[model samples]
Target: MKIKKVKPYNQEEDKTKQLSRMFNTISSKYDQFNDIMSMGLARVWRKKAILSLKPYKHDTILDIAAGTADIGIKAFEYITPTQITGIDVSEKMLEIGKEKVAEAGLNDKISLKVEDVSKMNFADESFDAAITSFGIRNFDKLEESIREVHRVLKPKGKFVILEMSEPRMPIVKQGYLLYTHTLIPFAVKTFSNDPKAYKYLTKSMEAFPQGKEFIAILNQNGFNCLKYKTFFMGVCSLYVIEKYSS
Candidate 1:
């Protein structure tokens, strides 16, 4: 089945442009909104995603869609990567992320930039490992972005991704839907600068391919799936993929 393409707004702009504007609008409250939506489990999930790269060579890491540097900041707690380079399309988001990195005494360790994953300027084989947390669903050209990531990583380099997913268990699915569609929207409307952003986020999650379907995308883009695991009854998923050595 062909997956539906979702955009933050109903206008003529592409997903990348719309997403950048949407995130910039809500960048200040993005972390708080995440806390409310995940009930604080976002941190735990991010920790796990970063730790998944611990066994690999991660001296230099690329953090894709690194909004507010959450994954980049959390990496220091789980592993000893010498440097982390974060890229995002939203300048405001990266502005806030830079502040946080400085405050966390990571100013020298982490760097934030405004760049799109699909068109990175870095040379090939630039990183030992790469990671993205709750960000893949927003990729306008998923395959192109994945291919870029593959190109930037050294042979055998690991790429870890953490993303929200629809629950498959009957009971869990019902509860998940209720929380996402009803509670999340209500909360966003009540507290967010752009209420419609969460609506797009939820809709995108529903339309995104999951499980084996997503694994297939990785495999086709020069990545070999090493592990796939779900958290909280499949509300979230973690993917660990490696670049083919050859």
Candidate 2:
């Protein structure tokens, strides 16, 4: 598949817009790059994230930055409320997601839209659960996105997240840096033309606050039940949180 070329990211739009533009440009080859870089472990990581949340039948789930709707598609099995909405800020991403939803014969069940995670267009308490798989770290105002998520969710709503992290173990962390920062970019350059996107991805993950710091951010955002589950020996993690009821 050919990756679309997006204009250079403008620093003027804030960090979130720049990141969204980067992902939107590379949307076509996203699944491929993710699978190749993770050695197909990304899918397993996503499954672990989904399992962290306990949803009843037909729950209203809002998946943020849901590129091509992978999590939304997988979450279908638990959609007792019939289906869920997957929203992203990228029009190109939503287009691809919509196609996938139709191909899965879940067009009626799952809906896709282009909306910013930091400022949602939904009503209060509109959803029962929400998730952003490896997506929130790109938010310009990560706290704003978390609180935005909180506002749209009903009391006690589940919030699940799968994110990349720098390993805490001294040796493991160095190995991770070598692989993600160096080898991953090499692989992307070889397999895809837009190598800068991969380069940016590496830098962004490195800049993100992971593990305990991230959990602290969640807590600050009013999220309880903070559980950070490590996978692939801590190369990545899934954070599950909940907003308590009054």
* Each prediction's RMSD to truth: 1.0, 5.1
* Model 2 weakest 10-residue run by lDDT: 1-10
lDDT by residue for model 1 (120-203), tens: 999999999999998999999899999999999998999999999999999999999998878988887789888889899899
Off by over 4 Å in 1: none
Worst 10 residues of 1 by lDDT: 1-10
Model 2 alpha-carbon drift over 4 Å, by segment:
1-10, 55-58, 78-81
**lDDT, candidate 2, residue 174?**
88
Query: What's each prediction's TM-score?
Result: 0.98, 0.91
lDDT, each prediction:
0.93, 0.79
Q: Which residue pairs show collisions in model 1?
A: none
Residue 237 error, candidate 1, Å: 0.2
Per-residue lDDT for 105 in model 1?
96
